[model samples]
Target chain A: MEEESQIPKGRYAADISSINEAHARIKSLILKTPVLSSTSLNAISGRQLYFKCESFQKGGAFKFRGACNAVFSLNDEDASKGVITHSSGNHAAALALAAKLRGIPAYIVIPKNAPTCKIENVKRYGGQVIWSEANMRSREETANKVWQETGAIFIHPYNDGRILSGQGTISLELLEQAPQLDTLVVPISGGGLISGVALAAKSINPAIRILAAEPKGADDAAQFKAAGRIITLPETNTIADGLRAFLGDFTWPVVRDLVDDIITVEDSEIVKAMQLCYEILKIVVEPSGAIGLAAVLSESFQKNPAWKDCKHIGIVVSGGNVDMAVLWDSLNK
Target chain B: MEEESQIPKGRYAADISSINEAHARIKSLILKTPVLSSTSLNAISGRQLYFKCESFQKGGAFKFRGACNAVFSLNDEDASKGVITHSSGNHAAALALAAKLRGIPAYIVIPKNAPTCKIENVKRYGGQVIWSEANMRSREETANKVWQETGAIFIHPYNDGRILSGQGTISLELLEQAPQLDTLVVPISGGGLISGVALAAKSINPAIRILAAEPKGADDAAQFKAAGRIITLPETNTIADGLRAFLGDFTWPVVRDLVDDIITVEDSEIVKAMQLCYEILKIVVEPSGAIGLAAVLSESFQKNPAWKDCKHIGIVVSGGNVDMAVLWDSLNK
Candidate 1:
């Protein structure tokens, strides 16, 4: 909690120094995934594209960075008590692996509707699972109950200073890898990845344009950007399971202030982008991870007057935790 | 024919100097693909695994290296006459793209039974197609007819000196990337890739063990390794379409002296390995490309006591021109 006081207020909510510290802190724990580009993909979009493949990150996503920071930042006393989070995605696996590295317990609250494979992944990583009914309210209530009983730290998926700052470390690596990048396209779910990247990239080079790619079904972030208010979808129907969640409190501010624009893409575009990734780049990109490229190829993005000069683009492939059922459905449908 | 004088003769037929020249010639043309690794894959095999991802290579395979060398090595007179080859796979696309880079026309003789997608790829790269009946004899006849009619220089897929030297350049990149590698795994089709890699790797470090992976159905190389002579299979059947070709004369001598062993894996094993590659490594590995990793996981390889000491291993992912029909069928079957 003492670290909370050190967090900056207003425009500079996340410290660039804190991101640097997080990079050093989790240096040995995570992989610095390769920045890949393709000749065919570049030719199609008429842009020099660079893909930061975080799908190859530890725990199959960039969540490992933030999760590791949360787990390792805890003092011995807090670490002894352990940490808890309600997640059915890469975050659960990330937190589990991160806690296991520190020899601490990780409590994961997974909804009953989550796939059996995801639950098994959390268990395999040494997480204690508490099952709840399928719904946000149920998931939060169960997680709250666990916290009340054990006094474990609640590691939010996106809405935490430590978590957001840790995820921001990606930009530090990306900027160094491709210093000439003019625009960066990121897929936004609960907005942790984009928030972290935007803050770090802007601090490094304020001229760099930060854009968010969102699924049309879950275009809360896009709607928020245009209307200057949050818009929660009653239901999300996109094939990108990882992008279903809306923006969180801690992430929304960074995204709103630092991010240049939000571009929405349909599920068809995501599948097409994924097909290109496999066909051209020889990489398996889950739907959410593929959205960055989807946005780049979209009519809205390509025709945007503001983005015409964005010849050098960086795309963030956020995760590779593929929901196979969704993939089959998307492909067939 | 004057260029043929530069090719060394005797037991050590392919000169190291020739490979060095090829490396210098194609340095700017080809990509130095990264050697990737996985923690979970390493844990499963109990060895540090490094993957040379030629799947990400231009034209989606390592064949581009050889083709680029052959196309670029031609003198102005030869270049003006253009080039021709008989291939219905990655080689045609590779050769077509390579010739296009040098402003020379590439003629491809494809069997009538070849897939429409493959023909489209050749055309996409500006290859002029001459159809032949579905057999090796017809393919050769068509290519010879085209060559005689047009005086186009013939580029043998695996047998040529320049191509082998160009393919060997991968070894220079891999060895420089991971100097401590104790074993190198390569998937064998016509043996061009393995022969080049073995020669280059051994030249860099004599102690490095070079092993070949082959499909059981198309196991000419593996059979040759065991029998001390080439045993061309009368009929080949395998899901690894790129690995169906028999060994060529120029590559066999290099393979016989340099390669340590050949490991054969089943189509089932190749598919499972591909699934693991996509699930764990987040990379799309075609059936042919995944065979190297599959060999390491094979029962015989695991039981062999001689291989116990081999800790750090490098696996060449040969190509990523995946057959989607094959992939879908494999998954469903």
Candidate 2:
């Protein structure tokens, strides 16, 4: 990885400076979510852990940080024309609220099969939802058409610098809350959150171990890191819908250079971890948010002897806007 | 009411000073749980609300506050001999953990039909569980026999002054977190939590309106408040097992004198409220805890013109140690 970094071909990856700018821009718009210690998870994982509870954030997900930053960073003229994006749920709701706050129209292209609760949330936030077929091509085409027709600014969910910076705010809060933290475990989807967190953590304390967790079904980041290149999946399958994307060009280098390791967890393990979070922590965590804890509890990283020396760990609980029916089925299983 | 207070016999009632003393004594042992603001509930109820999340306390309920105070207040010889109590679930777990912390044996007499999860928690905390028939007489007889044989200190779950004072710690924390709160709502079960909260809130700010929430199916507290005397229920038939007891003599006066009003919510309303808590707040609030929100959301209290002036309202989320299966069922319904 260091050898690859020596090459001058890759774009200058995200750094603490970019994250700091993003934090300053989005601070007033987004909540400073708390870092809560989980005694039960600590006892089970044998690692003193702090959970960055982004589930308590507005729109019940950390996506709001990125959405707000992306929308707010837009030029006055561009923002007046409004913004358009494609998402299953969280990003749409986040963008809607962020745009609404700026008195700008938000056009969200969502898959026809998106959960009702999320769709309702987007509409409640005054976003215009344009339904697309349950496929990425349809979603992209719909969003592009909306952008072209309405002349609205296109906000890529994870590929944009502002999004990564906004996501990095989680690390800023975590490091401030627990300065002694030696390791950070963040769930990776398109590498946006982890990329930002890695940059922030490494910048503050270069010795900090930045780990990435991903569902096995959506393990594109792990494969990408292993191949030393960006990898896209032909198809995605996971209960953690928020973590189903492949890494973008912008996100790849930041994750590649900053993150120490990427670990994958089975969907069953993710569900079981979610159950434990609901039972013991009394907090509802979507499947993606539970993956980091799942990896630690399953001892996936224990093979690395350096992990044994880790004194303090922080895990980002990415989101909690889950459908109750789906949660009920998962709990029963 | 003021004239009644002037009577010599009624003047000796427990007040805020006693509640404050109890709070001071237990402040070190109990958790100062967070006060979570709800956007969804606020919009629905049209009231600025803060949830005093006692559900996050150690032992997963407010019962721990009372249990810890009761157990620790015991004399050294009595503490060494251990403590025994009879409860359906929350009280048993609370007493077990509190006693375990003191390195003393805890004998808990639970009904045969107690949830397996609660029983497991009791054993996990090193408490000895003695099964009794699922009735008041059988539980009392079983606890008495164990106490007589072992010379264990008997810690009454709700009827004791020490227990009531211990529960008052929640009010102290709540007011400290949100001192500007104009109204405080709490669920009533044998009037322990509400009694403590009422006394503490009255002591802190006499103008703060203290409201009691009770399930319609088990409205013993409501009846007691209306009749100006304790009213025993013919049968308890609510999912809120934590709020199914009759008001005790010590608690009755507090409810009548300190509590401004008593409101009732239906079982279905409680289930709906729990679903909302899980879906919106992402917190696992037990049915008992949900009842206070249920009263506010269902307009049971809102219809009262006096409540319209309440600028800041505080609700005590008393417990969260609910069975996953039960939560699943409630969410599905």
- Among the numbered candidates, top DockQ falls to 2
Model 2 native-contact share = 0.54
- How accurate locally, in lDDT, is each candidate? 0.85, 0.83
Give the CAPRI class of candidate 1: acceptable
Alpha-carbon shift of residue A128 in model 1 (angstroms): 2.5
Model 2 alpha-carbon drift over 4 Å, by segment: A1-13, A326-333, B1-15, B326-333
DockQ of 2: 0.47
DockQ for candidate 1, please give it: 0.44
Candidate 2, A153-245: lDDT as tens digits: 998888988888888888888899999999999999988889878777776777899889998898898898899987545787887888998
The residue ranges of model 1 lying beyond 4 angstroms of the native Cα positions read: A1-13, A115-117, A323-333, B1-9, B115-117, B325-333
Q: For candidate 1, lDDT tens digit of each residue in A58-104?
A: 88889999999889989999999899999978899899999999998
lDDT of 1: 0.85
Q: TM-score of the B chain in model 2? A: 0.92
